[model samples]
Target chain A: MFCRRRNFVVLILFCYNNHRERFEKQLGEVAEVVMKAMELPELFAVFLKIGCLAFGGGYTVIALLQKETVEARGWLDNNELTDIMAISQTLPGIITVNAATMIGYRRQGLVGATLATAASILPTFILILVLTHMAWGFTDNPLVRKAFTGILLGVAALILNTLRKTGKTAVNTYADGLLALFTTVLLLGTGLNVALVILLAGGLGWVKNLYAEKRGAKKHGTD
Target chain B: MALINLFMVFMKIGALGFGGGYAMIPFLEAEAAAHGRVLLENYIKVIAMAQVVPGPFAVDSSAYIGFEAAGIPGALAATFAICLPSFAASVIISKFYAQFKTNTGIKALLDGVKPAVLGLLASAAYIIGVKPLYELSHSLASLTVLKAFLAIACGYFALTQKRVRIGTLAFLTVFALVGILFF
Candidate 1:
């Protein structure tokens, strides 16, 4: 463990040495941001970029933010990004909105949070209006139906791709894999309450942990 | 009364829209159907637009239904209501980020919740796909060779290619337009 810590420190120092100039630039900007009062326009512009470009929603926007904040803006590092994504997933609303609000509030407090939230959803709101109108206007056109059918087909594949990615993160063990499979069957084949399943599965996780802990303790005692 | 009803409907949708984004599509469709203000086919088109358009699908669908029900006020109200729960959640979450991140209990619970949500997401995809990709509206004979080819082609392209959503959307839009000119 001590060697591991030393190696990690060495790795960070090596990385910092490699990017010494960039690191200094980032530190100078960080100090500047800390000294200045947060501006609403800046906040709005940043979030507008995130909101508009996140066409695929969720992770696509998250990836965009990762690029902007980590690579370009130097606001967050890899560890911070992972922590934020983890927290956002636990939140009840759209992960994108949760992420925006969190990032805003972290930087500029309540006002920043408000502006970011507004900026993130504003493009979506306007786009929704335009789409609602287009749907109404094009209802008589059979071509619209055909195009939508094709879009639906594409959406299915897109969703499957997303599922595969999420599954990689969510399924870590045999137990997790079994739970995922069961939940899939329950949802696809039956009209069971999803809320109930979530609660029950969560309970199962706790129970599994407790059982494993007890077994490990027993083995240690025998040893 | 209509405005209040609209608010309540969307609040329910937001509450049940676990996993969020396109996962909410199935829930939004059911709620809109229950309201009986729009046909299923029309609602499907609206969902497709929400998917193709550059924004959050959950809000887009809510706004669509709200506009269908009452107009601008309905649209605004429904969007706000549906977003309220998550906004509230964000406030609490951002404040307690450190504590929540370190909590083993929450971690264990999320272990289960995440996979269950995964199932819901897959279920959403299955429900949406079955009608458009697999089923025949009129009869088995109505499922033409051309329709199957187009569906497979779109699905394969999207599934295989990177960043094909916008390209596929543009392609399908033109495809549909030219299709009518030919037929």
Candidate 2:
């Protein structure tokens, strides 16, 4: 037993001696990144860039966020990002913004959350403001009007495309499909408030789940 | 008063627009129509612009709606209001993530909300598309038919194409050029 212990200690010393330089270098790199991620300014800058480049659907930004936070800077790992993403979905509002806020809050607190959220939306806000101004100026020109007509068609097409993608994931059951159809009819055919309609649909869903649970419990008791 | 109303409407949207961006469209359209401040045509245009621009769709739509209702202050107010729910929710969730993540009630609610969001998007699409499709002229030479054709073609490509961002921008640019020269 003593000889075995001596051999194990020799192996440990050999490994330590061989990899000491690389180990220290890795530690220094990790420390630098930890510092960078902890700083409020750095957090703002990263999220700002993320906002500026996060184009297309909300899902697209998730990849970019993961890339920036997990792959590039090492501030988070895959699992932590996944958790943030899952948490973001549970709350109201944009997933990307929610994610930014969560990550910032985790690192720094309310101020960090505010700063990160602001940075994420800043570029888009300015761009939209500028575009709106330009659109106002061009509203009267005949050619611009013609172009807008075409753009309107494109907008319709875009919405339909979104519908297709969202429906694929959301409508997994017959009840879910029926719920969607009911919503479409109510929103299109009635004067109901959109928020109220949404809440009503949610209530129906809750009731459905509750009923299903009761039935399952009854079946178990019978068994 | 206009700014306050705009802020309130968007705050509601932010608080309830589960699944975000695309889901917020119906709420924005309905609220804007309720006030009759921003025209439906204009709101659709804003959606198109939002698609091409960088950042979240919700942010762009709120900013445009605010700008339409009350200029710069309106824009700021709407933007801040729409974002406030997200900010507040994140803080709350950060505090209670463990419990929130496991809550079945919230899960079931979201399950219902998801399908309803799909429905909302469908209704909004119908509202936006009816005008162009209904007005398509019979003449082959007219731009309306061409516009309809191009829109469908663009949509088809948008669905199938791998590189969405560049493809979308290209399609829009082509549609614009076709509009300019054909007319």
Candidate 3:
């Protein structure tokens, strides 16, 4: 009688365990779906805030993104951030946008890419729209006009400063400097289409590279 | 029609705009002129103000240009169009970046393209500065020209020189204030 009672108790316990396991599994799946739903919105909010604070230019945003994603959220580590930045630099786009797309793509996929890109741009889009409209209304004011003129002078300085900084990187050799000068004259003097000018420059660069490579090969062959 | 033109113009700018925001200035000016959407001086002024405002230079300029062209819709179109190339490029790179990163051909192309971009930027700086310098030349004694000169000199010194390290935004704000008070 004792053995039969013990078997009955064991059977009840086994049934309870099976039901509980099934219930927990279903609950976990639901939770996962919910988390997936929340992720895109969370991504949008984070990037929108980043967009608002991404001042100065694209390069500055790299630090901002690293701070938010690595330190605050722990979505990425330092090495990943560096890799993303390098890839962004290699591609032909704004680094910030490229980084955002890459991060989003890593996290979710193509939908995330589109969402993050839109979020990153939305704040600037809105801010510029509002400022431009207001500036239009205020253009009639002479004080505003004077301020704009002054800003123009400041901008010229700023551009030249940028030119100085960029020139350091772009113009390494004498040939590069000459090429830069050639580009300036070609654009300003001829008023050529900027796109065509860029293509011409790229073609020139490729041909130059090919020639150098062949010469190097010949030197190596002789050696 | 204007919206389509704005989109195409910016798309071209995006594909070609390699160096950074500043490097794209010449392209923006040239495209706007070619499209005949905005006045040259007005566009330049917008670019100037953009320096003071906080955001990516490309996005801010695109919005203003689009708005000037066709109101709110134009702004949206241009902004989206400008970002499209970057997005597409990133997508492809994200997939194949391991190999793409070390490609010699791309490295060589970028090598040649970068100097040309610098040249383009230099020409833009000259175009922007020529008028102010010309005015300064005529009136060495005028307060307005002096103020403009002071702004530029101080900005250049602060940025390029190591000792007087003021931030770009801070420096620009002070000059804007100076403009309101004196210019």
True contacts kept of each: 0.53, 0.69, 0.63
Q: What DockQ results for candidate 1? A: 0.39
Q: Which ranges of candidate 3 are over 4 A from the true structure?
A: A1-33, A213-223, B35-38, B131-151, B177-183
* lDDT on C-alpha atoms for all candidate structures: 0.70, 0.78, 0.77
Comparison by TM-score, 1 against 3, better one: 3
**Which regions of candidate 2 fall more than 4 Å away from where they truly are?**
A1-38, A217-223, B37-39, B131-150, B161-166, B177-183
Which structure among the candidates has the greatest TM-score? 3
Candidates ranked by DockQ, best first?
A: 3, 2, 1
Q: Is candidate 1 or candidate 2 better by lDDT?
A: 2
- lDDT string, candidate 3, A1-223, tens digits: 9999999999988887879888788999999989977899988888888888887775678888888888998888999999888667545556678888988887768988888888888887788777766777677587877666666666667777877877777777787777788888888778688888878886786677767777987999999
Residue pairs whose backbone atoms clash in candidate 2:
none
Estimate candidate 1's alpha-carbon lDDT, on a 0 to 1 scale.
0.70
- lDDT (C-alpha) at residue B2 in model 1: 94
Residues A66-138, model 2: lDDT tens digits: 8888898787889988988876765678877899999989877888898999999999999988987787767
Q: Which has the greatest lDDT?
A: 2
Ranking by lDDT: 2, 3, 1
Q: What is the lDDT of residue B160 in candidate 1?
A: 58
